[model samples]
Target: MANPSLKACFDRKKFVVAPGIFDMISAKVADGMGFDCLYVTGFGTVASGLGLPDAGIATYTDMISRIGRFAQMSRTPVIADADTGYGGLLNVRHTVMGYEAAGVSGIQLEDQEVPKKCGHTPGRRVIPAEEMVLKIKVAAEARRDPNFLIVARTDARTGLGLEEAIRRGRMYGEAGADIVFIESPESEAEMVAIGKAITDKPLLANNVEGGRTPILSKARLEEIGYGIAIYPAVGFLAAAAALERAYSHLKTAGDSNGLPASESYGFGRICELMGFPEVWDFERRWAQPAAKE
Candidate 1:
């Protein structure tokens, strides 16, 4: 059965914290660790899958394939970052349908142009508010399932200003966006103002590490009236740091003896976590069945 829709989470009024996952292994790990939802981050996807930055370098096919893997491997609902819906109004429709068919519970579209950068990164630019509004409308109309969420994101905070960001967010919500995300609010006061200004729809907060926005706890975010908080780089950054340490230790010590056992997962444990046992069981049951006498 499908996991509960993100709309259910919103209806419950509970703050949903979706950890970002880029690949199959991370998706399985997050599901096993009991995360109710997973975010298919564009930044993590480009970094991990393509060995590139999130500067709109990943193509729509790249994102769809990556997000499809996550949705297939994870038991939790997946919310995908569909950056700028990959193009204009028609492109937004196609992106929405493709993601929904891939089993994504939600799709996030931004207001930036084709070569959109990461929300926290500098040199980001947004299209006109009316242009984004049309995209949002097309995205909302494209989903076959009403429960499939449309998250409209505005990168106008740093470019145009907080007030303009708020205005764009409100416009998006009015255009049928299930959620409005104002990217990179510089201060808590700005967050509060956004929360107050956009009250008609649920809001999503991007909790990017070392990014522009302040990292607030889930409790505090709920207090600030955010319905969803996504930690888009926690897993990727941690994995990168650990790999760096592991490589350095191997170069110096010539072995992994110095690595802490608690922090490391053994080969067999990793296989189990990835359901190798189930694969073997299926093989035994079907591939080489016992004699029926």
Candidate 2:
């Protein structure tokens, strides 16, 4: 049976803390970690693999194929970031259907215009409320599964003010979005205000490291009425820092003699983690008798 929580991911029924899984290795690691859900973060996926910023550079084809891979390989349910639904109404429909078919439990579609900037960064602007409302409606209608979620986000808090952002959140909830995400609330007070104002549906909090929002504990986020918090930058940030340190050491030392073995994954362990044991077993089972010498 499909995971019940995929359908039950509304009304703040359960709080979820989803770590961002950017690639197959991260996905495999997190899939085994007992997390109830995982987030396919756009920023990490673009930056970690493509060495590019998350600035609308990746197309839907670029993203959805990877999103499908994440979904296929992960044991945990996936909530993917679908920036601006790729385009207008028809695009919204296509994005929604595609994400659901690709096997994500939910998709977050933001209200920012195309060539959309990251939510925490500057110079972000939103579409008209009516326009995004239509997008939300189309997304909600596009999914074949009634349980599949439309996570409606408004980047109005960045360039626009918090009040406008909250208003848009409310508007989105009324438009049939399963969850309301008011992106980049800078202060706890603003977060409280969002919780207070948008009472009809569950709320989502974007917990980006070194980004605009304050990082709150799961208890505090639940206290503030957030049903889900996605830490989209955590995997990539830690991975990037580790990579820089390891590379810097190797360049300075001329060899890897000083780099700690503990710092990097053991090759054998990695092969085991990535299912090489299964391959080995298949090879053994299929092997022919050694030739006479």
Candidate 3:
């Protein structure tokens, strides 16, 4: 089970910091760090898994399969991005079933149209508020587990302005969403406004590095009255930098011996991380060598 259910975390009234984990490597590393929740970032996951941009190119099948694996491997509660619920009302129902059965504790459903763009990126448009409200209603009803969360994300901030985004956030909350995400609030004042307007449910703050929203500390966000803060870009960005440095060093130096990165997390440590000890123990117990004579 997702230890300390995400709903419980919200009910606790303390801030929750969920790191964005894109792949199993990051997943294993993040899950062990003891965060109350983990966010499956669509931008990083789609890029890593499919070598595609997160402009709604990946299908529901693509996202659910990857998210399912992460949720299974993780002992922590996972909140995955389910873009636009993959389609309309019927699709929303199916997505809820798939994500719930796949062990995701929460799903972030955005209000962008089909082929949705990333939240902080430009040229994003939202579906009518009325349309997204119904999607939220269907998603809320489709979830079998009552605690399975429905996070309604409004990308209206970039296009429609802050007031409209906050209005939509309030609407979604009233429509039974467990949390509200107002994407791309450019200023701290806008964030404070969002926090104040949407009071019924927990507010999710997207702390994307270099994104429109300023990166505030957990304490600042809690002070601003946000409930969940997802740092979705940190893992992928860090991984990209590390891989680039290592690859650049290897190509330049022609040897792994004198690399810039410390090699302490080498083969043995990685093997332990990948649970090789259990495999070796299984082999020892089941594959005892037979006597020659």
In model 1, residue pairs whose N, Cα or C atoms come closer than 3 Å (at least 3 residues apart or on different chains), thus clashing, are: none
Candidate 3, residue 257: Cα displacement in angstroms equals 1.0
Cα error, candidate 3, residue 127 (Å): 0.5
Which run of 10 residues does model 2 get worst, by summed lDDT?
1-10
Q: Cα lDDT of all candidates, in order? A: 0.87, 0.87, 0.90
lDDT of 1 at 139: 85
User: How many clashes does each candidate structure show, in the order listed?
Assistant: 0, 0, 0
Whole-model alpha-carbon lDDT for candidate 3 = 0.90
* Ordering by lDDT: 3, 1, 2
For candidate 1, which ten residues in a row score worst on lDDT? 1-10
Leading candidate by TM-score? 3
The C-alpha TM-scores of every prediction are 0.95, 0.95, 0.97
Query: For residues 1-293, what per-residue lDDT tens digits would candidate 3 score against the true structure?
Result: 33347788888887789999999999999999999899999999999999999999999988888999999999999999999999999999999889999999999999998989998889999999999999999998888787788999999989888889999999999998999999989999888888788888889999988898998888888888899999999999988988888888789889777874473368888999999999999998899688898
Model 2 segments more than 4 A misplaced: 9-12, 291-293
Candidate 3's TM-score: 0.97
Report the number of backbone clashes for model 3.
0
lDDT string, candidate 1, 67-175, tens digits:
8878877778989999998888888889998998888889999999779999988999999999998998888778888778888999999989999999999999999
Q: How well does candidate 1 score on lDDT at residue 30?
A: 91
Q: Candidate 3: worst 10 consecutive residues by lDDT?
A: 256-265
Q: Name model 3 segments beyond 4 Å from true.
A: 1-4, 261-264, 290-293
Error in Å for residue 10 of model 1:
0.5
